[model samples]
Target: MKHVIALDVGGTGMKAALVGAEGELLYEARRETGRERGPEAVVEGILAFAAELRGYGIEHYGEPASAAGVAIPGVVDAEKGVAVFAANLGWENVPLRDLLTERLGGLPVALGHDVRTGGYAEGRLGAGRDADRFLFLALGTGIAGAIGIDGVIEPGAHGGAGEIGHVVVRPGGVPCGCGQRGCLERLASASAVTAAWSAATGDPRATAADCSRAVDAGDPRALAVWEEAVEALADGLLTAITLLDPRTLIIGGGLAEAGDTLFVPLRAAVASRITFQQLPSIVPATLKDTAGCLGAALLAWDLLDTEVRA
Candidate 1:
């Protein structure tokens, strides 16, 4: 059976799959990125991993992978197939697409920003599949967004568009790594919540999930921290709604896994803050952690379609 390679490269690990033409995952695998070994090592690891997947496809499916797609973290220049910069991975202007193509014996390859790819999958195949316009927010260690329009995620000029995390929500509040104060991620992300809860509980290992449990138990301190996060998140989302007017808003990532603990209050807060902006249906992402891998598959399929049309 013919298949394509889909890879999602994160800071610490990579998720990959062999996807069939019908969008089914034929095979899946995971590997460590070994980022601590430096940028060059990471690149070599990616190349090796892609090559291995290609070989596995050939051996098991009796056909080589026709194409490949890679979703990577950081500022990516998708048009040029370059990974612009990834602070966590220590990458700078890496020609990842070209390297992968060459390593995979010239198979066509598509590279994209990780979050944008995930949003694209959500727009085309997940929560926002039916919406003409949507915004996908991932509230993990850090917050990031993807803007989907007419079933496609817009990468924006310079590939820096969906940086909703950096939006100033607190003004003079917390200091951000981007040299800003009170950024949305500083207050609303899972990491931020974990830090606050940990500080409050005097337990260095306390996590956001712990806070959720505390809130469920009616702990006043946990409720206070959770409410603060919800308020900041609502404020940031309101700013996005005012600017984009998306039809649906999809929330995913670790914090989103809190289920009603996060969404019930979040929906109410967002609703209360809205004045004239059309209220968007706030929903959870269905694809979960697999979104990025599936999204990479979509990119690979798109590359094949583009080639056929050309």
Candidate 2:
């Protein structure tokens, strides 16, 4: 009946769960990140959320949680257990792991980058489970990626590796918040497609989902928008494939919900672009939004193991 608390803190909301030793989810919950209120408020919200989950585990299992894990966006120093920076949350250099451990009565807490942590789940339990090497991409409002090797997500030397979204595919095309022009996310992410589709149809509210439906209906304008995004994505992915040579490519996040609409053309586009690089299996992710929580649990469990070994 032992369990750990898992939390995935996103820009707008947080997903949490109580996970057993065998990776079974005992309970799940969600909360607004309260980012609009301010960074300090957001930190307090996360602490409160983790405390509540810990309380639930104690009440149900008659013991406190063994450990806790959290995944947050932006720059994170996992080794230092500090959330270095998160633009969406307006946070900088917050000692999140220390804060959580203090809140949970000294329970060990692991902090990770959201995309990389989610890819850890996908690598071990989802589409990348069988691959020795894989790249997991989350095509959300903004694209992000994780590189997995030998069942582990590589944190890279500085912990900023696997940032495929920042790969420049369209030189001098569009400006990115990261201070780059023609970054992959600006050209190929869900938000990019939404912007393109909205401008094309003169509907300010048109979304990437709407574009997908229109593509299904054989709308030429939607086809144009989708194709543009697909082509840019292919260009970016080709760079990853060339550099990483992964055996599998797992696609997740909101835009990935398009399923075949995104996959079929994407596969063809990548195939057409690749010459010397071996084409990796382009597959859709199975965990959806829950991957982050599951991965956070994995981190918590890993932390417990490391503690026992030490």
Candidate 3:
């Protein structure tokens, strides 16, 4: 069986897995990104991770991987394999693809944006499996989105199409880390939820999980904060639905773990606003945190198939 090494690089950690052609994981490993250091150190960490995976593949499977794929955050030029800029990681115009290829002796390599890859996996095998058009919203430490249509993932010009997090859900409400006021990330992201709840209740120790627990126990403040987040998210989704008319809207990332607490109100809010447009299904991401890795491996497999066709 031909094996591929898939790497999903996040702001906090990097997840790696050995995936077969059939989308099965044979082995996996991950490490903290140590992003506070710098970009070169991050690249060195990735190389070291890949080297360790190479050793594991050689020892356990009796050979090296057929190819490798990597998914990264920020603005990624997948066709060029360059991360144009990653503000969190302190990287700009980094040639990650060529760097990895040189380190791995020129084996085939594929690079992609983290959310786009996650959307690809969802469209192909998860929540959007049957939908011709769908949107993937990731609400983790930060917020972003990905769009898929007709079984094709459109990365848009400059590879930054589906960034709905900066949609200004609340005008002049709260400042965001992205140097903007009232971006959706500042209102509805996991961190934002925690901060908003803390600020509203004057409890400095409150967290997003705490807010969810309070909502479960019928705490009015927590419920109000959570409801505001859901409404902002709904407003953003309304615009997306009007434009794309996606058949499904997949919610992924840490905040999505709230389960029904997040989905129930979200669907209701969307339904309330969406009268004339087609109402889409709001579902949790099936692959969870591993979607990026799986989709990266799938991109490598696509490259393999393309080579065969050529």
lDDT per residue, candidate 1, 4-100, as tens digits? 9999999999999999998899999999999999999999999999999999999999999999999999999888999999999999999999999
User: What lDDT tens digits, residue by residue, belong to model 3 across residues 61-84?
Assistant: 888888899999998988898999
Residue 204, model 3: Cα distance from true site in angstroms: 3.5
What lDDT does each candidate get? 0.95, 0.95, 0.90
Task: Please report the TM-score between candidate 1 and the true structure.
Answer: 0.99
For each of the candidates, the C-alpha root-mean-square deviation to the true structure, in angstroms, is 0.7, 0.6, 1.3
Residue pairs with backbone overlap in model 1: none
Candidate 3: stretches off by over 4 Å:
none
- Per-model TM-score versus the true fold: 0.99, 0.99, 0.96
Sort by TM-score, top down from the best: 2, 1, 3
